[model samples]
Target: MPANRAFVLNSRPSRETPAGPHNFRYVESDIGEPGDGQVLVRHHYLSLDPYMRGRMNDAKSYAQPQPLGEVMVGGTVGEVVASRNPRFAVGDHVVGSGGWQLYSLSDGRGLRKIEGGTPMQAWLGPVGMPGVTAWYGVNKIIAPQAGETVVVSAATGAVGSVVGQLAKLAGAKAVGIAGGAAKCEFAVKELGYDICVDHSDADFGDRLKAALPDGINGIFENVGGKPFEQAMLWLNPFARIALCGLVASGYDGTPTPLPDVRVLLNTRSRMEGFIVSDHMALWPQALGELAGHVAAGRIRWRETVAQGLEAAPQAFFAMLKGGNFGKQLVKLVE
Candidate 1:
């Protein structure tokens, strides 16, 4: 048996944000060989996402609270070092919910084998959950028509970036709202957005309104605060909003004050919140399409990778505050 290092939730956050490093306790324990029907995997990359913040709370929500003293939940891309199951073999690469650990033991449930054509890290970002989330929200929910305008907040983020790109692929004008000037530049120059507004600017609302003179027909709402409220002001008739995330308020668990619903009623606009997991039926289709886009280089993605497993907490905290660009990940192995 070899020692496996893991991060466990030691205390609940008093607020919506992570309680700090003191709340996560690192422990090393002996990992036995895989039992019959199980596989032992060595994690290479650990995903850091905003949604994990909500799971730390004791409050009621779509998913249950993360139990105290248990390994923190997260997505991981790893290699099977040993396998007792016929379905998986040594040296196989897999994607699964492997938690915050150096290694994991699984029975192949919810595990998907990944091909080697693309970077393994891509399996956690563009061609994985975030990409599928964007695909479903854009193609299925918003369904923007050509020449329409679609606005997305957190535009440089994993999901938001893909949302903008997908909108452009559909011949729609994609507008982005991001935190700083650099991200705004990347959104327009690299992601092919028509325009990107810097939320940090004092005149952000004015800028957003100017960019979409034709009004917004669809919205991929990622940050649900004033940016969302501002987007509401420019809704075209029959506008659709795919409420993918609320990273703005997720950290503090604060209630987001919404704009008046009278506008929505007058415009007959639609706004719906979605959990990607709830739409399991669409995963295969979404992932397949996303994979093709990524493989052909039609989709460009960036990563802010922390070097080691020990760096996961800081990397995760920075991601919550918009400190990282693109997808946030922890590279656990060389």
Candidate 2:
């Protein structure tokens, strides 16, 4: 029997402190065989996302807190190495919540088989949760019309990149807000954004206003601090805002209060906060459209891959701090 190497939650992180190595402990345990109706998956890639930071806390959230002495929860794309279930077979690739481990044992629940049309890692990224999140936000919450201006923060990231591209496909001007100069350039040149603003710049607000002469018709809010505040100043009448994430204060306890939330009221704008899992009914339709776009080369994506299972912890924190570009993943297998 082979040993399974995994990272377990050693302790819960405080709201004030960022999660680190102290929060987790690596464990090597003997792999056990499946009983009946079970499958063993060897993880090829593990996704590192910002939402994991909120799960580290012991506070009440939409989801349960990550349990201590258990494997850290994450998205994984892997192949079935062993199967005792009729639903799953050996050599079948799958995507599921397999946590931060080299392998996962499951009873075939919550596992979706991969059909090999897209790259394996893409299933964990652009064609997966992140892509679906953007789809739901753009298609449902901040529904944009032609000739409108749509903006997305964290523009070079997994969800934000899709939001910008989808807005463009809707015939709206896609304006992206990213952290550094390089990211801003990539958002415009590589991702086909109309204008890319550098939120890290000293005159960020000035540049943001200058870029939008027609005001913002819709916004996909990923970072909530300065970017959200600045976007408020340009809200068009009856504009819509999709509150996707707040990576700005996910680690720290403080959530920067909007300079004036009345902006929503003032412009009669709508701001909706959504969790993609809550809308499972929309997924098949969403993934179908996204897969088509990706397959046809209309929707492009990028990845920041960390090497080995051990790098998962480091990569997770780095991604939360905007140290990574696009979707961050750890390659657990060659």
Model 1, 237: alpha-carbon shift in Å?
A: 0.5
- lDDT tens digits, residues 164-252, model 2? 99999999999999999999989988889999999989999999999999999999999898898998899999999999899986445
Q: What does the lDDT read for residue 301 in candidate 2? A: 88
Off by over 4 Å in 1: 15-18
Best by lDDT: 1
Residue-level lDDT for 53 in candidate 2: 83
Off by over 4 Å in 2: 15-17
Cα lDDT listed for each candidate = 0.92, 0.91
Candidate 2 to native Cα RMSD, angstroms: 1.1
TM-score of each: 0.98, 0.98
Question: How well does candidate 1 match the true structure in TM-score terms?
Answer: 0.98
Question: What is candidate 2's TM-score against the reference?
Answer: 0.98
